[model samples]
Target: MTEEKIEQGTCLRCGRVATLHRGLCIDCFRKSSEIFTIPDYIDLTVCRSCGAQLKGKHWEYGGELKDIIEDEIHSSLQELSGVEVSLEDIEMRRGGEGLYHVEVRAVALFPGGGVIPTRKALTVRVKSSLCPRCSRIHGSYYEAIIQVRGSGKDLLRQEEAVDRVLERVDQIARGDPMTFVTKLVKVRGGWDIYVGRNQSARRIAQEMHRLYGGDYKVSSKLVSRREGRELKRFTYLVRLPPWRRGDYLLKDGTPHRIEGFQGRRVKLKNIETRREESVEISSVETLAHYPSKEVEMEATVLYTSEREIVIMDPVSFAEVNIKKPPGWKRRESVKVVRVDGGIYLL
Candidate 1:
């Protein structure tokens, strides 16, 4: 006897004996099933000061408003199981005050077999507010103070060194948005820079000490407390060396031009003997005296020889015999420096 087989392809909605998906025909399934759900509208928070967006609980410097809106929409959608949805295109138009109408064209793929083209529309409301960083910046908040001071006797020299450090601060801020200069206050001897981040201040101080020989000290003080965490403000005191490169240093009545620096020591070349010398940066301040009588001026060359050259003194216009510097040739005008009652060709 032939067994009567049970029929199993009836759609629950249309009662059609056909191929079924989840007990429903493809047409009925597509009509009744929603692959994903998106809200009718979404609210986005933006920083009015810097154009940053607030995602979840954090503030990010994302580019452009349209790109941010697309990201928000992706996070807002809820997809059902066995369905994968991808947005193919997005069209945005301004819809009256602070509202944007977003239209998304998407494709949904079912794991077993079907691909459905879909379209979604939603409204995006943009709300402007101040971000945390912008709030702190506007309020003049600072985490560190960099004090740039020089040990030189000349005020012009001190000012020049301090200006270099100030220029460096701008470079550091480019890579790190959180690091910024809040205020610059001119003090008696040098300038004080109030910085937004503590780590940035340390970088400035380290670079300063490395290029120009100097000493720096970092001190921290308890400033405040928030959320049961202690907040501390840091102070970096940077002192440049008394003598800079190219300055004349007097060692036991002998004049030496400060050539360069190597690690913790300074390199010097004797003006009279042409001998090279090295001295610790820490001890140079005491052992070498900054030639107060040092002055550089242009002189007229009267005669030239292998080891010696004659020049007309710039001040007195009288011929003066001086030792020619190494690799120096005959020139109409020569650079000469007066140090400790002696004239030497530079």
Candidate 2:
């Protein structure tokens, strides 16, 4: 029989004769060395009300609870250098209220090609606490107040302005949970909106000024001092213009109906000339504001001519002759607006 030859490899510890890796067998190195380390127990705090998780010093929102816990687990794990480690087959069981027992298999990929698997069991203690924002909100804390006041003569227009403020608040609150309305107080002349955050209140005021052809002013007052910092309460005053959309105004002795706003410009439709024009918002401020609920009337067309049309007033039931628009067509009914003492066809 031929003599069999035995392979010899130097293992740093056992002097084994087999495959050697870094002066040691792979199995012996794995058994003797530490692949990774993880804490035996981890603590995670959560907001009881908003379901927000506490990460470090801030509250994080908008994720599944299980995913947040997994992140916490990953954050607590420490891996060896040159070893790509990952967790697999993570199993979690609720031991009791605010307690979680977790079992996970960690796979460490060593440099140059070796895999070491380790299993660990850890306890996660879930602590429930009120986050900073939620705590302030529960205490009815407000940093700013938005005062929505309308200068228009119509109370309906003022109410509409208030409604716009409310809609804007709802939209802004969707992004930031801290941006909330603490209370809405209806006072004389307008509505007062108490906001939880000053930044959100300022944004709402600026948006109202941009869209509604109005102006806003901000003021602050020293409320108190805490933690060696001054706490100031802010107030945002949003004032709507005297004329709103669809109202009529007299520009340079001519009647013009307010159509709408376009980026700080006022769109107007001249009642007498039957012309549509856009002018600077500041220029409209010089015009005489005329707001009337009965400005628009549907009249029965009695006669039609090239430059004139006769119609029966819907309210007075009397024949009224008015200048027709350039492309005015003969129709049974015509839309007219009462300008000064004359009826004009639109």
Candidate 3:
């Protein structure tokens, strides 16, 4: 005789109907066969809704309704102390339906202990903020619901944590030097130097003398300001010591280097090449009875005294006495021309 076939029923563990050949559903089978229950601490708090976790805020536990409270405590400790911590062990006492109880083990590194379990245990309460499965499917930005087991320990000591983090940050910032910006201008008798926008040319001249030591004169020129207003811009003329201009030095720290005079020989290259020549001076005695302008004239220095020099125009034999002020010397040469002015060899 042949036996009749019977319909299958749902498995009590997973609620899925069993197949004709199998007594339990696939989900129940997998759960029963797995050797380990809780894989890691992070996994224990997975939201039943979306299974998403929290980040940034230290100790923030993100996930299902069961883990919200623990995550908050974790986030708080992390912010107070610069350390990473994890839940080590968990004991689920009562679960399912509307209530649950759990004991969680936490481990973190401390200054005193290299790595150790926290002496204070954490008991959390589990509550449903969102549906475990639905919350996992769709997330909520408006509200956060969590099931806390019990109040957890304050992992970080308050004052010490704040000072330590601040000190470390300050040390890093102080390692670099500060920097600023300014403008540079070339003065009439001075080299280019830096100055602020509000600084005056006279102020810069004085500063240059203080820093480099030189005689400076300030000149003013009109410049256009905004909206067609005219404003005066001052320029400083510095009389640099001759030695400063050249590669020589004097006992009084003055520069004795003559710009146009290269030793005793007078370089007539520029004057001879020019078509027209004019002479300027402080006095007209050296240029008396001479023409106002001249063309094609040869110059020569005859004799030089402490304060004046005697020069004669080689072309016309015209003689002239050129005055040398206190700063002038006999070793200097003067250019003589038929013109009414004496052109000194700069």
Candidate 4:
């Protein structure tokens, strides 16, 4: 909004006429820019647990190895103070047997409002170390121990479920920055899992409840007291259900299939009556031993009727007639088990 003031001059190197500073035009000045600078050698510290980098006095959690290396090199450089430089591209690769080449592309503003692109190189040197959290974990430092246990036949079942939960939690921990498992020890009845953090152990117990119905109890030990407050390490006792889903529990003269479990309650359905009942877990206990579902025999349907269905066991070549299972069909195979010296459909 003022008068147009055009200062015309000639470039020093190319002799072009335009707005000039220090006997040079904007284009020629930009071609001869010298603001970008970096050091020859840089040292970097990378965390193995979270892959974070320590920059000067602060730790940067969102930095990759290459990016941190470039930043360290840039920080050690002696460039014009109070000027902002933009990093365009950066790369690092091994050039020879013991040498690595680091190339950093950058752009800086010239005196006459021109952008100058400059590329620089530096040697890459790295030092790796564990952060505080990971170091604590490696030192067998844990806040809680999760004990998985079951009684009677459920002991084996609980072991399987614990293995599955450990596998799944380990998969999750590979990507989760907060979770880690220190060790898994096999005991007589079940397993004991040592966890690095309390939250991670709680999460594993929650997953056990979700995948397989169970209950957990937490107990804390007072290790030390500070200012009337106690510092404690915790232990979690996770008890799996006595009867899992689809498992048949022989109570009295009836074998009831377990539907699921509620809090302190066991849900069961009669295999023949199809009646459902929920009983308190304390009121019932599993039998000494029960035939496993894996050893069941295949039964082929030979005849079907509205009142009853006849099926032939291919293993023993015996035909057993029971009330038709819902959705019964002809010439179809069904898995059946031998219980109490009688054949039953499962």
Model 3 compared with the native: what TM-score? 0.20
Can you tell me which runs of candidate 3 are displaced by over 4 Å? 1-78, 81-112, 115-204, 211-214, 221-232, 243-346
lDDT of model 2, residue 34: 65
Off by over 4 Å in 2: 1-43, 64-96, 99-124, 151-156, 173-177, 225-229, 250-254, 260-269, 274-293, 339-341
**Candidate maximizing TM-score:** 4
Clash number for each model = 0, 0, 32, 0
lDDT to native, each model: 0.79, 0.79, 0.35, 0.70
Name the better of 1 and 2 by lDDT: 1
Residue 222 miss distance in model 1 (angstroms): 2.6
Encode model 1's per-residue lDDT on 176-294: one tens digit a residue.
76777788888876789898999988888877777776667889999889999999999988777777788787776777888887656789898778889898877767765554345
Preferred candidate (TM-score higher): 1 or 3: 1
What's the ranking of the predictions by lDDT, best on top?
1, 2, 4, 3
Cα RMSD for candidates in order: 8.3, 8.1, 28.5, 5.7
**lDDT against true structure, model 4:** 0.70
For model 4, the superposed segments whose C-alpha errors exceed 4 Å read 1-12, 15-31, 35-44, 48-51, 55-64, 70-101, 105-118, 123-129, 151-159, 164-178, 206-211, 288-292, 295-297, 325-331, 335-337
Give the alpha carbon lDDT tens digit for every residue of 1-346 in model 4.
Answer: 2332335687778988877645666667556755556877776677777677766765556577766666676667654432347778788897654346888888765444556677888886666777665777778877778888776566668778778767866776666644567788888778888877777787777767655666678899988899998878888887887666777677767677778877667787776677899987667764522545743567888787797778886667877787876776655877776666566777
- Candidates in order, TM-scores: namely 0.64, 0.63, 0.20, 0.71
